[model samples]
Target: MAGLIDKAKNYVAEKVANMPMPVATVTDVDLKGVGIEGINYGAKVSVDNPYTHSIPICEISYTLKSADRVIATGTIPDPGSLVGKDKTILDVPVKVPHSVLVSLARDIGSDWDIDYELHIGLTIDLPVVGNFTIPLSTKGEIKLPTLSDLWSKNPPQSSV
Candidate 1:
């Protein structure tokens, strides 16, 4: 009886290990907006679901780091579901306070850009398999808006 149970467990494990799962990658990270609080950046994730049915996304947690310091970190719970048998694009937003930018002046001043690493945890509920987390990470440089670029957008109106 013990041998029979062990064989069953091994078979199940092998099936689960061979099952196709969702794959995700970070496409891009760019500046989204600027506000009094600071700057808003967004990370675009592309998830390719192999199953024929939609998967419920449990949560999306992210950490933004620069110069070995954490700039932003947060979790988005129950964001939504991934499209089945298709590619789904997800937007993850991160807000950095003005103080944090000020602290990283040394790195930013060099090339007028911020070098960052974004870490993401995408948790999805798979049928029969329970919850699974897909870890993703990407590193890149984001150019800061120049003074001229800002001025061009909101140009000062000459007093009439």
Candidate 2:
């Protein structure tokens, strides 16, 4: 009987050890706007208490898929910290004029899909056991508004 229980436990662990992780597309990187900025990333961790008493640190990587189907990838370690407990606002404190650059296909369109992935982790020393990434998604729209479109919303306008 004990052997059966142990086998079951081992099986469960194995299953969890190699489960499919959800992919997150970067919704936005708020840090790019301001110096010592806090990048606001949107990706909900499906599991409860992903950190579990461990400091959830993150490594951000930038990637781009051009309209021409060209794939470019670059990683930024310790780009910022995951701000908040459990899984909340993934705020990454970044340096001024961040080094990471994500250039889109200007030939196709001005819109670019910037991906800022948060890799929740305790410590790199712990190896795979400490590394954790919430299978959350990150993607959104950030279209540049025109001057008229931006100003027309406000009142107190008159032709002088």
Q: Write the per-residue lDDT of candidate 2 for residues 1-160, one digit (tens) a residue.
A: 9999999999978977875432333333331232233222222222223333434444644332223332334444754343323433343332322133223335214443332223322211123355665433333332222345335543221110
Q: Over the stretch 1-160, how does candidate 1's per-residue lDDT look in tens digits?
A: 9999999999999999999999999887877767789888888899999998899999999998999999999999999999989999999998989899999999999987788888999999998799999999988877777667565664222110
Best by lDDT: 1
**Model 2 alpha-carbon miss at residue 99, Å:** 16
lDDT, each prediction: 0.87, 0.36
Report backbone clashes per prediction: 0, 3
> Scored by Cα lDDT, where does model 2 land?
0.36
Ten-residue segment with the worst summed lDDT in candidate 1?
151-160
lDDT of 1 at 104: 95
TM-scores for all candidates: the values are: 0.92, 0.37
Clashing pairs in 2: 25-138, 26-138, 27-138
Runs of candidate 1 exceeding 4 Å displacement: 151-160
